[model samples]
Target: MFPRLKVCCISSVEEMRLAVRLGADAVGLVGAMPSGPGVIPDERIADIARAVPPPVMSVLLTSAQSADTIARQADAAGVSAVQIVDRVGPAVYARLRTDLPGRSLWQVVHVTGPEAIAEAERVARHVDAVLLDSGDPTLDTKALGGTGRVHDWRVSRTIRELLDIPVVLAGGLTPGNVADAVRAVGPFGLDVCSGLRTGGALDADKLAAFASAAGVQRLA
Candidate 1:
């Protein structure tokens, strides 16, 4: 029922370029973050949106508290979609669910294992799609995603199977295991962050290499 993801988590324009060049289907723009993994300003997300050429979707990573405001911000920036946190209430989710219909509003849920995943799989129905990430919020940083931790592929695989919607896998994935992941999870798409970057920033070469190997051809 939902599209799979070949998503790339990015925080800067350079990384956006790499995602575009290397053929990423989507980019996760960090909207609001305190000190760690997603340390990007709202303005920067706008900049990244402009930088991403057509066909490459932009998913604004916003907290539940600011999903609405950030959704507006994402629209102004011309982003493709907004990936809201699970805490997003029904009202916000409904508003965002169809805010940009035909586009998308992904939900990022933290599922550590099968039971947690089953619960998430049920709640995951609220949004258009689901993204699997690290459960702990304390370890979040501006430079990485999914705690830069390798979540069990089994979780992604189960969710993908349970949900008719697209399931995007984003925990810890690299070129080395990406292909295997694509096959193992059988998800609509895969997302990458710290695994493909260098020093918390995108490495163009690595980005390209990973993209090519991942089979999600570059857009332009």
Candidate 2:
């Protein structure tokens, strides 16, 4: 099977539906963050989470630091899974694993260098998946995501080879380059946000093109 497609940063119910129609295996709803795009209210996140039908996962992107805080926020948001953007300790993940039993946890690894390989391996032991991205958290404003700059797929490919868990490649992916990314990285999934949008809204043409490029003919 082809790699799964996760449409991230979905701001509205309409966007979620459109993503589903375009063959998204999962839709990401950003809850809150220190700095980034697609930050929505808890109520809206919960609404979108509840509105999503089965088999299509509702992922809540969060920047909460602690396991307790993330657990509380994810529970309130009513999402099927949580994609943690911040760098949290292993203990936090262990706590989350115990606290949020049924819920899935996905960790985002900012591919800065070879160190990212070890980081991905460590995170993979705790989380369901590791998303390799290009965001630099140490920036003045901190670009956790939505930078639209492609990272080193070679590094991501190394991370994919080192881990037993799935690795989803993100950061600056579009229909034009998705095929190349898939071949180069061989990721278990692809998480796209800015690549599928135009003027800050989801574009049907881009979505269709992306799905075709990713070989996602049907969502199910």
Candidate 3:
């Protein structure tokens, strides 16, 4: 099957609708984060989530570590999936499984090095899918997602090969390089944030080009 398209850092209901109309299979609404772009209020996130039509997922990008806090944030946002942008233990995932029964839990693995392979493998069991990103949480001022930088595709490709669940590739993907990313990693989906935006606003032309490059046909 063709890889799915996910547009991230969506700030408003209008952007969400545009992404869906342009063939995005999912839209990412970023919640409060220690350091990252596109962090929006919970109320706005909930509004966007509610506006999203079926078959199009509303993914919440959260940095909450505790399962209870994460679950509460997810509940407030009313998102279909939660993308954990920081490292957490297995216990947290286990609790999330029970707390958010039917919702999808996606873990973000920062591909800083070959060690990321082990990290992805460890979390693969808990999450419904793994999203490989280019962010360093080790920094004093944690750089989560929305870095707009690319990581080693070879490492990302290895993670995709090792995992049984779907893998979504993020970080610095653009209309120009999306095809190369697809060829290199062969992820189950493609997630783009800064690449599809111009001056922090979602650019229709960029979004369309990105979808086309990723082999997504415009939704009828």
Candidate 4:
């Protein structure tokens, strides 16, 4: 089966609609981040989330680590799911299970090296899915996501093979290299942000090309 497509860093409801219309299975609404693009306000995130139609999920990308804080952000945004950009403890995931019932929790594992394999394995059971991205969270400023840099797909593939949960591959995925990524990682889904945008805006042509390249069927 073709991997599901997720368009991230959606700045508005119009962008969200466009992404869904163009065969995106999910849309990512970025919350406040220390460093990265598409850091929209919580109110805007909530507004976009409310406008999202059913079956096409609205995901909130949050840097918040605490369970209560993350739960509050997710609740306020009213998103279908939450993507934790930073590493958090198992307790946070456990608390989120209760605090945000029925909502999907996705954990981001920065594929830095072989250590990423162990990191992803450790959290695979806690989240509904694991997203492998190219980011250095260890940096003083912290690059959580939206770096537009591709990481080692070999390491990502290792994580995918090890995890029972679905794996979503992100980072530097574009119309140009999505097929190669799919071949290498064979992830359950593909998430794109900067790659699908041009001049800080979602490019329709790029989105279309990416969907076609990824073999994603347009939503009727």
Q: The CA-based lDDT of model 1 is what?
A: 0.69
TM-score per model over all chains: 0.83, 0.96, 0.98, 0.98
Point out the worst 10-residue segment of candidate 2 by lDDT: 1-10
Cα lDDT, model 1, residue 82: 72
Q: Clashes in model 2: which pairs?
A: none
RMSD of 2: 1.7
11: Cα error in model 1, Å: 3.5
What alpha-carbon RMSD in Å does predicted model 4 have with respect to the real structure? 1.5
The global C-alpha lDDT for each of the candidates, from Candidate 1 onward, is 0.69, 0.88, 0.93, 0.93
lDDT of 2 at 199: 93
Off by over 4 Å in 3: 1-3
- The TM-score that candidate 4 achieves is 0.98
Off by over 4 Å in 1: 1-9, 98-103, 137-146
lDDT, model 4, position 24: 90
| lDDT tens digits, residue span 142-168, model 2 | 778877889999999989998988889
Clashes of each: 17, 0, 0, 0
In model 1, how large is the Cα lDDT of residue 205? Answer: 76
Local error of candidate 2 at residue 74 (angstroms): 0.7
Error of 1 at 82 (Å): 0.7
Candidate 3 local accuracy as lDDT?
Answer: 0.93
Residues 84-185 of candidate 1: C-alpha lDDT, one tens digit per residue: 654556577666666666657777777566765766666566777788776554344332244677778887787788887777787778777878888888
